[model samples]
Target: MRAALPGARTRPSARARRERTAGLAFISPWIFGFLVFTAWPILYSGYLSLTDYDVLTDPSFVGLDNYERMVGDPQVRLALWNTLQYTLLQVPLYVLVALALALLLHQAGRASGFFRTAFFVPKMTPPVAVGVLLLLLFNGEYGLVNEALGAVGIDGPSWTTDPDWIRPGLALVSLWSVGAAVVILLAALQDVPVELYDAARVDGAGWWRRTRTVTIPMISGALFFVTVVNTIAAFQMFTEAYSAYFGAGNSTYSNDAALFYVIYLFREGFAELHMGYASALAWLLFVVIMLVTAVQLLVSRRLVYYEGEQR
Candidate 1:
């Protein structure tokens, strides 16, 4: 080949440069926010996890001490077990209730919009407000839930007070927020081709058969989306539990049963001023969530159906 020309550099035109600058300028806020608020904090926390930092003092290096202590911390184990129980109870029930509600709303025809909005109203309610409402309804005496149960000659359990019933109470609280999942599933249901259901019916499939064979497979992507989202939310459960049992840092009436993992982390970090230890807890939780999500994705490979994929 001939030798290259000395002045053969090709730079972007002024218009192209201007367009690129404008695009970068438009996204600069998001970039800055992510770097400052999300990425930096994550990295800082990871560093802090290896130190013995109280907020009042500088972080002094303490390699693996926090991680070692975590293994023997009874409170951490309690919190983990409680959180696991809550997740186990909440996720499946939430999905089932959401799917059922979506199915009912889908069949409502003229009343569909009204019913959907009504169901979603509970989700729009603030978590604090929901906590208050739950306390009022589940109070030991003169609560509406007990009153209804009494009317049927069945005494309702003391939901908020009894440790045995605390997880169930929290489960009920979670069920109230299933409206968002229902709305998502409803949207997915609408997108599914009616012709598929019609074809299933023509092939002598009944309602259950149609749902299992057509509706489920068609909406599996949205189902998987909701499952993954709710799984993450369940793992990071804090606000509702805090508002319900330990608002304003008051741990009164909060039993070990209700001590969720994040609540324990909050107590250690802010209340006890063990910021470094709390950072370690946060990182551990992050790892748990990642592992759980990975397992789910692996399982979903066998279950979740994407459109246009070969059999």
Candidate 2:
């Protein structure tokens, strides 16, 4: 080989430097925004979680006092239990209902497109508006839901006022937004190979058998995605609770049944001004969500069948 040029290494390195500089230049805005908005806030919140920080006073370092308080705090326990209960109630039911709706609508033929739009209208509605509509529909006495029950000679539960009905009422509201998941599942259903169904039918698979094998396994990815997202949303439930009970100064009327984790965190951070404790609560919520998501992913690894991945 000939002797290496003196400038060869320098030229390649210089080109790399230029390319790196260009990449950095392109991403600098996002970097700056993330640092200023997301990363810095997260870091500062972690710091705050270890302190006794009221908005009005300087933060005093208190180690894990905030976290320790969470153990003895009845409200914290109530909020956590209530959140878990809501998650248990909402996520599975929502998934099942959405999947059923998708299945039904997907087979509607000429009416499928129109019905899809109608169903998706609920998802497109603002959360606040949905909350308002829910309040009206489920109002204890004069609400249309109660009125319908009365007409059927069945007394409806006091949805907004009674503790026993609070979570279930909220679950109903949550289910109304299942249109989003329905849309996703519907798209997944559309993408499923028709030949697979034909082959399954030729193999003497009944409708239920075909659905169990061909429909569900094939759409399992979308199901997994929607389930994980809904679980996270269930954990962070606040707007529905706030709208149902706390809005219009009705907090006093409603009991702890509706005091979801994020709702309580909001109360602590903003209402009580326990910034440090609130930060701790926020971090705990973050960890819980991450852990739950990790568990879901792990389980889905065994259950969820990707279209092309080897079993």
Candidate 3:
């Protein structure tokens, strides 16, 4: 105590040095792979967006032209409309469904685990397989959906064929895979303080009032987070719509009902080999998403109630 033992500040601990070195060594592969595969392409895509690269002709530097074309393209208009529609409708519907399912599964019950697994099964199935199955289920003639409707003495509309219903049919397929969000919400619901419920009960708060005042405010952050994420996912939907209608670019709809934003961009980039234009469109989509996300963040600050703050 009199000498005040050297505070070990001068020594580099062997374990600390070894751990740092080992971590760098372990993640070197990932760093290298990211640089080669992901980072380079993203950088190059920004460069390519300013050129007219069609693979057949030499990439001529035409800055902003591809972007201009995308701005004026009618297909872009329809694609944006479809993308916005899917996002606005499906995200909210699935978010509400997930919340309701979470509440149901979180109740004082024994079969909750089984219900969770059942809900999650659809999410684990491959998207392509889901698309193929939806084709069979939503098929206009001799399909399971219409067959069941016929048995109930109600006529079913041509879901896949009707221009008005094709997008909704696709939405129905996407809505089936709300399992991940449901699971997340269920976990959040479980995290909510049980004492709050007890307090509410003591104050004579009924189920609806308790949910509205307690469950909703506490879970608002999770709900908003899920909405933003699902909105992004819905905006990027391509495989189901593409497989259902544009496997060969020969759909018979008078207006391209299934012409989703990413599908249109994919056709421009890979199918038509218009890499430059697709890059431009990709950048535009990125900007749009950024703006939307910023708005959500700003708006969420008003609605999303975090714990420990007085609502």
Candidate 4:
């Protein structure tokens, strides 16, 4: 070969080119699936949001009417308010419960593995099943939860029927699936240096003091991750609320309390066949989640601590 000129780029060798082609071929299926299933649907949904389609007819462009309708829609406002209340009630409670369980497991030492598995089994329960269980457990009169409360001479509210208590009941139900967060937090706890605890103890720090000053800051990254994940999940809550209150033959409960945003979206799209309107609702949810996550990330910079990160 002639000597290469300055700044001249060299072509890949035959072997390198073949390897590159093979790598692309190997990942082609995933790339195709993502494009068809994820990317296309997302783009199409954005387009659909600007149209009026009832699934039976071709879409007619409606500009921003669907979005505008949401501004004055009582059901949309109620659903959004319900979803917001549930999320606010659920996220902090869920995080605290998960953290408490993680701390307990951390102290369990030899029994941690068994307890971890037991706790995680609930997370594997289907959401529909969990919803059914929620009804049974919080039935107000004869439910096990009320029965337990009665043992201490306290009466429990009708969780499924009472509007005031419905969101709290849903929040309590959310705590049942805290196992994944517990596992994550436990892993983070394990990674925390023992020397930190020892140093704190040497400084006469009590358990709570050490946890507040040393433990929390060290595991702040994991705490932040758990909060963010749970926040998103809470905002998107659907199956459990739907199965519990919005399902066919379930008219006894107060639906307004459980009419979460996703449940309304599902009803609009599939039940009522307002596909375009549902698409608009879906896009609004996407924007809300993105904004909320951005806020969390911005706040986390001041809270979360990472190893080797400069103060």
Highest lDDT among the candidates is held by which one?
4
- Say which prediction, candidate 1 or candidate 4, comes out ahead on TM-score: 4
Output the TM-score of candidate 1: 0.91
In candidate 4, what are the lDDT values of residues 102-140, reduced to their tens digit? 999999999999999999989999999999999999998
What is the C-alpha lDDT profile of model 3 across 1-311, one tens digit per residue?
25546774455689989999999999999999999999998888999999999978888999899988987899999999988887877887889889999999999377888999899988988887777777789888988989999999999989888888887778877877889998889888989999999999999999999999999988898899899998888888988777777765535642388888898899999989999999988888888888999999999988999888865
Q: Tens digit of lDDT per residue, candidate 1, span 1-311? A: 67758989767999999999999999999999999999999999999999999999999999999999999999999999999998998888889999999999999998989988888888888888887777888776888888998999998998887888888888877888888998999999999998998898889999999999999988999999999999999988887778878876446565677899999999999999999999999999999999999999999998999989988
Please state the error at residue 115 of candidate 4 in Å.
0.5
1 versus 2: better lDDT goes to: 2
* TM-score of each model, in listed order: 0.91, 0.90, 0.87, 0.93
Candidate 2 local lDDT, 1-311, one digit each (tens): 57778777533688889999999999999999999999999999999999999999899999999999998999998999999999999999999999999999989988989988888887877777777877799999888989999998999999988888889888988877888899999999999999999999999999999999999999999999999999999999988678767788675557688899999999999999999999999999999999999999999998899988987
Arranged by lDDT with the best first, the candidates are: 4, 2, 1, 3
Which 10 consecutive positions of candidate 2 have the poorest summed lDDT? 3-12
Candidate 1, residue 96: lDDT:
90
Model 1: per-residue Cα lDDT at residue 250: 40
Ranking under TM-score, best-scoring first? 4, 1, 2, 3
Residue 206 of model 4, lDDT score: 100
Candidate 3 — which pairs collide? none
* Poorest lDDT segment (10 consecutive residues) of candidate 1: 247-256
| Alpha carbon deviation, residue 47, candidate 3 (Å) | 0.7
Clashing pairs in 2: none
How much is the lDDT of residue 50 in candidate 4? Answer: 100
Off by over 4 Å in 2: 1-27
lDDT of 2: 0.91
lDDT value, residue 187 of candidate 2: 96
